[model samples]
Target: MTNTMWMRGVEWLAASAADPRACKWEWDHGEGIALLEAGRFWDVLSVPERLGLLTLDLLWRPALPVPGPTLVDLAAGRVGFFLPPDPDGGWVGAGLRYATRGSWVAVPPPYRPARSLEWLVPPDGTGTLHSPGTLEDALRQANGTLAVLAAPPRGPRES
Candidate 1:
């Protein structure tokens, strides 16, 4: 993305904070990351890195449109995908963690990478976010794939 595009993305992300100016100041002063509230403009669905990676791969496999912003926390082994706020709290999946209203997420500056927490897919500055239904489908598929891979190999049938 161009510098202007990145700046726009940064602005979009900073707007998530209660005080966008403060958030921007933090980023400008080399704070690297800031905790932003969720469930206002968007919510976050976080999953284990392994599953998240698989889900992301599946999400990109087809000719489907690109997904929204995705943050990967290497130290925590987690990945957070941005989605439009769901007031009904409808999302549910094994090992899934949703950051809805009143929750806080440590977000990095969209213009640059942070230490352990960085964007796997940075925002495009259009307020675009992942479709909840589409993301849920991909998560289910990825979970199944992981389960299959983890299952023990079947031995020869008993004679």
Candidate 2:
């Protein structure tokens, strides 16, 4: 998907997390999947907004055979997770042998706007699924130096 489209999707996900009626169920990438439904993986969208957010993204690891949307919490400098699973099988991400069922992991930024998934550090594929409280803590500990990176770059000042 295009960058603008992706950003809009993420924004929608974040905004509609609370009201199920707003987040309608639909197929993603032609796969029969619900976009965001309570008790489903997409529930992460409901993550409280108090956590300074950078952007949310959908990770499509071809090796795994399904696509998963990830919430990129830049203020916390980590990729938050609460997904269910891929339709074909487990979820695939950077680094690691197999896929993870569901859990939160640190996605270190490269001190700039993320151009691709390469910018993120893959989850270890094992750990306790992060709670909203845990995510809040993680963001609390993240360095602020890169927080600026999350913002769109400013153009040259007018003369």
Tens-digit lDDT string for candidate 1 (32-119) = 8899999998999999999999999888855778988999999999999999998877777777899999899998898776779888
Each prediction's Cα lDDT score? 0.89, 0.34
Summarize candidate 2's per-residue lDDT along 37-146 as a digit string, tens digits.
32333233223233323222112224332223344544544444444433443323232122233422322222223322222322222322334443333444432333
RMSD of 2: 15.7
Off by over 4 Å in 2: 1-34, 39-42, 45-80, 83-128, 143-159
CA lDDT for candidate 2? 0.34
Instruction: Tell me the deviation in Å of residue 127 in model 1.
Output: 0.7
